[model samples]
Target: MPPLPAIEQPAAVFVARPGTAGRLGQAVSWRQLMVWPRWVTLAGFAIVVGAVWAVVLGVIAGAVLGVFCIVVSTGTALIRRGLTARRIMRGSLTVATPGMGMASRFGSGALDIAQANGITRLFYDRVRGIHVDRDIVVLRYAQLFIGFPRELFPDWAIELIRAHRAASGTTGYSANIPALPPIPPIEQPDVSMVADPGTAVAMARESFRVTLRSVAILSAIFAVLCLFLGRLLSHDHGLAAGLGLAVITTVWLLASAVRGGPKTRAAYQLSMPPGEPLSARFGSEAFEVRTASARIRHPYAAMTSMRAHGPAMVVRSGGIHVYPRELFPENAITHAGMVNKLLAK
Candidate 1:
């Protein structure tokens, strides 16, 4: 009888779509799009912004403005989720770690990785958190996190990572230039995708509806607030403020209308093409999304809401994933709960 080694002596190489998985794993759920550290930063920003506005528009009004900024920022982040993931997930992934360092420092190892932008050596101790999302492991260190597919990393490898991750700390940006040991190799697969026209149109319509509804709600709230302010202030001041607020609100509405315009549709139509066979390996924790261009995973628990949109399946998780309904069964599905949930929703 013998005990297992930390991990296979040297390195275990893998071809991965780490960018999307890393981004996806950073979020536990759509509601928790921001990590605690980020939320703290946001809070600090709100306080500072609120304090500045408080002087101009009294306490309550000033506080409202600060909150509005926070909302806008969060909304922007949400809206950009799909775009960010798609952009970064493109191109090839480069990764390498010293065999000795990986084994010896299993409790505090490091990874040198490169993407479309550049290369970086991420120290395990600097990682903010480690999330084991089903078949993938994501080590999030501040603004950096790389997801390793479980298929590539064996049991001991994962344990090593877990051990190293458990001892993580922060030191700002992890080595960005990879002049260090275990420099990553670079290779790119020239590939392009244009989503299915039908799916694109459906997603576009759904996206437009969402934007329009959000803008409408915001417009209504703005009108009511402006009217209230008109009565709250003196005659001339109230009239002036009302006109200004009305103008501002109107401009915002117009801008939002344009956002859901043809440009948005074009983006949707651009991101996906006749995707090859998609593989969704369902398990207790999450599910894997495999295609010719990319292979990523999503935590089933992250699905905030699921609904039907024509022939599409609109899933609101870390972001809105609009899938053609027929695509679900094209590959594989193993989880009953997810199936049940999707069906129920």
Candidate 2:
């Protein structure tokens, strides 16, 4: 049998400049609202601001202040979006494939993205998922997210991309984009490895430890501030008791957060039902978690951090996913190196 030719990078593909109104709309639509951390931070901000307002004025004033804060946040987000859009419009944004992976350049800055494996570029694997829409083409690599303008590439380039995706054994469908044509199946690498239940528990514990420490530090700072404020104000007996209660409650909550990690780990174990072992796969484009009855795919971009923790590969993105050395004794080191390399790039 003849060897297949390597897939070379495509030439630079320029994105069409959208009108001012259209650019503004695109900017607003691209907001990171889907990212959980953004929402969590916003909620925290609201709580702190409302509490401060309530203490200064009254309940009604606090409610009004919260509403005003939310409105201001929304407006500020829109303004930032407009600024980003204007920046993109002013710069020359182009996409290219330097090799197997995709690369995009805006003005002087450029982003190079590819899968984790040393042998295969994400574009050739077909196993990694790609989503195409009228406005964007979102490519999922092992460690990065690449969203480029759909109209940036010509029809031929789009067809070539679809061809690669069709060849990959992906079974998903996108409603917003045109349906992809089927292609011959290619052999897929075995990325899935069954993980030890004990490892999962340990990972959960570590995650909780980090969270608890953060909360404890913040709580201590807040308690100190409250005490200082009480001293500054008239040290009434009732006010002192209230401040004492607040400190007690904060300490209690911090303790609970510390204890919650193990409980959460136990809950995860119960949810898994412990019939067969849990298996995880690292594909060209995404990560897959499989159980006896079901499988779930998570894009690599969804993972925020990946690093070597002793003999394990600890990933914290949407949640905690730990790959222990016991499971992949031979490949754990290699996997860690690849992840670190990707992250470094």
Candidate 3:
């Protein structure tokens, strides 16, 4: 028998640079984004326009308007494409071209990753990359994963490939693939406007209180409607007026008790710097619910008010109620006071 060959294990495994598209392969063009749904939508829009014009004018005028509308639609698509291309060039969007088997750039480019003995097949069209800070990762289109430490394999490898592709100008293997733009930083609150913990808590509480007051005011309008109904029933305007006043008072009392709830629904989660207060936001407005023990913050300003009612923490946004009271700290009175301050403004 011939001498057996010696097999040696390599020190470290590294993926080679991805290859460029060959003469047989074709890159996806900007036009490919427009699909059957787009065509169907366009057709539906045309029919709607045609119907409207026909009702207002005549068949000939309607047909002319519809044609004009369709002709102008292409410009809208072109404008969107221009914006997308600009964003891509600026690294605002990252795209991954998967190894598409027979349709792939090369004959053999498939790869797999394994975790906890489980394996997942990654497709060519799937984009798996990290944002600028390499902190949050967007995977398989729109799914965002944060809090997890940057993965050891995919992000580092993608970055390496991106660097190579960038350096190669427009001629590299992944040249057609533009690097995704870096993720923009999240805006933080301006603390100069905030003097201290009291200010922060007060700002949040007053906001909530004001929201309740507004709801109470709006509920008064309903009372006026009830008074009108009473007049319709009895013809005695005094009775209607009295009923309206009663209804208004009832609504005001209820609104004041609940701090102008039922507010919008909001979910609460805690991050680092343990023991920080709880926060809530109500659509561009922010509030912090503070207790003797801890504070909660609503960074988005989406929560208008938060108060403790019995066992549950009552959060009011606009006029909507949110989240169970049990979710907040146990001291109900303190938290409720904090909420009153937030809504007061």
Candidate 4:
């Protein structure tokens, strides 16, 4: 292996949803809801203004003052947005906006109405003492490590922060779009080393087979219920029945396809070393995969720290962080442990 490039100084750091696999290929999970307080406040402001009205001088004056306060607050937020953008342009850190980031960067699993109102950016001066290389912003908790106090934000509010950053152009903006960091050399711990490609393949295959079986069973059960329940009726709604079944089948197929993507990828790559943790490269000419798997070459110089997000792993490098959960199977833990053990060698 060749020597990796040295990192430069004065990098900015921000949090984002996990976009790819990070350290150990784990991803974080953050849920976002629509009815969170921030959005509720906005909605309530509207309702209160319309339904509850009073003619007393204090009541009218109070309402006017409240409205003014809301507007001023929103305006101030926009101003902060501009300042944040300036930080990005200056190559302080990378900011990921909506649709951009690690999976758990902000709204991990769900993003409903309330979550859309409160997401914000988190800033970090350094991740694990490594200077961030770009001005990348993340959709989730990018602002948690910074300021006088570290604040943990809910997913919904995080989404709103993203919106504010995007509208201000400070979010999702990367300065000079920092180049990908060089992969770091693996630090091996003392441990026995072995690569069991066959074992890995078998595991992946078995997992996929189980998933397929379950999906098939569910499909059949649902299909029969749809057909049989409708058959009991004597009405001439046969056409509607047929159409409904078709729709159900279509939906099931789509869901199954999406649900199977990771499994399929794992199965296809099963031939590679499995049980001992494997290092492999994936991607076309466009980009490369990042992970903490010891068998894999994690040559990328990660500016941020490694956060083990449940089944997912996160590595913040430059303007973006990678999440491994979206691509790998749930058996990642076994693989990760194996990789870590090997790297220990």
Candidate 5:
């Protein structure tokens, strides 16, 4: 009989402590918010608030109250971000090979989170999907998730994990695709800015907008589904149910717009240390953003959109990149023109 090939094991395994500055909670929150049920809940709340105000006050007053609800919601969101960051920073994480998968401990739970000595084995077979965005890697499993900083795991280790996932027949967000070459760092820009709390808030607002739009679309689809299910059960009741869903969806959409406007303005007012604005150096093939914390480079193809908004230029790809007009007072228009030209191409 011919000798069988030996089964390959994971290349490396070690305990990985979460970074103090890591936004693990934010990453997790993003994934959680992506669920349709969560969107429905949020929209439902908005609709209820709008309904109460409409009844108690007049139509105009109800409109005002709706606006107030949105402001409060935005403030709550900002506070949640801070709390999430703190909680994640206080947690401990360990990743291993051969046997154990990835485990995390929150609070004083130390190394034993799940009571299996605080270790949880996330077998590749359990992974429903995988999503990679910049510095974070998200492993989606049913309703639960495990998000970790990519820097904690070596490239080879990631590949090994993927190999196991493939062998287990679990599908990935991106599978069987050739990996793109590493983005080369571009030259330093003439102007630079340190990303502060305000900057983070601005980026968050943009992200929130994008997410809200997606949720809105999904909510609309869900309304249709509800209508379909209602009709499938009973013709008379189904008509009433469909109408109810339509009303709920309409209210949700209105509230979302009202809430989003105030949120964006609130984000701009977020407190942060005064520092230089983000600097950008545009290359023939790519652009780079430099700040005190990180330097990021992205090819033009990676940019999803670039548009001049009043005095500021907003560039969104994996995240929001803002170039405020104040940073380039002398050449704001010229710079925006150049960027618009590139985006058009």
Candidate 6:
């Protein structure tokens, strides 16, 4: 097995050269990312547009619109590929770090990768399959393939990844994989974020307000169209048509607020009461939160967006987690550092 290059700090394992994509090693292109997500929105637009058109026009028209829906999204995805590639090529460097995977006696079987956009932490346990080549290596995990170019990606790093993949009940193409180094020292937060009863409720209230602003604006636009149509089709007065829409809009607003406002606030409040402070622990591979209600875990690979909103570090994976900056250590782990450590959408 090939020996790994010298480590600068135990925390970081590998880092590519800067100022060029050739040195960045790994990149997730817009085309690859759009594969599954594009289908979701396309399907939605097709169903909605087709159904509405079918009711108003005819079945044939609805079917045509459904096909048109897919065509538009497909073209958009192709256009985005060039834009995304351009942004990725402008990368600085790619860094590989440790302490963010399945913690083992020898090592945490995780590869924390820094790319053009942000950090991507992949755990060996989650990797279902591996594809290795002379120039590139790709791991199949969670409905997507993450690729690493061997031209810039270190040999030792590749060996380490293949070895871990084999050990984690997965097969690797590499015939001889190197032994992993001992687990490095990891850092975790000792301070906990205590949830004030009022805080959660306030956050939920603000979220609902934001939701309302967007929804209401859209509803108003639709309402105007509805009024115009009603005048032409049903011969109804504009005021009567508008009034009917106003009632329906009111019901929609109430339903939307109820769905995510009160319930979400209650869930947040109950999960982390003052007595049971939420311990937001940072591991090399994942972010975990132990609350009174449940233990929530978010892998670094799954993180989509992160931002510091007001006094909180708001993170979005499949769901959202808001950590109060007043409680979370600011100097040790800066907002920029946190953003840089995870894959951000």
Best by TM-score: 6
Q: Which parts of model 4 have CA positions greater than 4 angstroms off?
A: 1-172, 176-186, 189-214, 235-252, 255-345
RMSD of candidates 1 onward, in order: 13.6, 12.4, 20.9, 19.0, 17.5, 11.2
- Which ten-residue region of model 4 has the weakest summed lDDT? 23-32
**What lDDT would candidate 2 get against the real structure?**
0.44
CA deviation > 4 Å runs, candidate 2: 1-200, 234-246, 258-263, 271-275, 292-294, 308-313, 321-345
Model 6 per-residue lDDT at 63? 67
Model 3 poorest 10 in a row by lDDT: 100-109
Q: Candidate 6 has which clashing residue pairs, if any?
A: 99-284, 100-284, 100-285, 304-345
TM-score of 6: 0.41
The sequence of per-residue lDDT tens digits that candidate 1 reaches over residues 297-330 is: 4555545565666676666654466655554543
- Give the Å error, residue 261, model 1: 4.7
Q: What do the candidate models score in CA lDDT, each in turn?
A: 0.48, 0.44, 0.35, 0.33, 0.48, 0.49
User: How would you encode candidate 3's per-residue C-alpha lDDT over 1-345 as one tens digit per residue?
Assistant: 111111122112222113312100111114223445666766666577556554544566456545644664566566655654443322211111223111011101112332111112222232333233232222221121111112323443455434433443223444444432211112232211212333333333444555667667756764664455345434544344436444644654565546422221101111111233333222222333322212233422344465554433455542233333433443433444455565433
Worst 10 residues of 1 by lDDT: 96-105
Q: Name every residue pair that clashes in candidate 1.
A: 125-169, 194-272, 194-273, 195-272
lDDT of 3 at 37: 65
Per-residue CA lDDT of model 2 for 23-90, tens digit only, reads 42353346432335655665676567557656655565456545654675577566755664544333
Ranking by TM-score: 6, 1, 5, 2, 4, 3
Per-residue CA lDDT of candidate 5, range 1-345, in tens? Answer: 111111123222334343422556667656654666654676566567556545544455445545544554555566755664544433322112123333222111001112111222243444556767676667775335566655544564455456656766423423543332212222445565564555555554554555567767866775675566446545655545445656666666667666656544443433122453456565554555543323444455555567655545567654455555333433533444465565653
What is the TM-score (0 to 1) of candidate 3?
0.26
Candidate 6, residues 193-221: lDDT per residue as tens digits? Answer: 66676666655655555567667785776
Candidates by lDDT, descending order: 6, 1, 5, 2, 3, 4
Q: For model 2, where is the 10-residue window of minimal lDDT?
A: 105-114
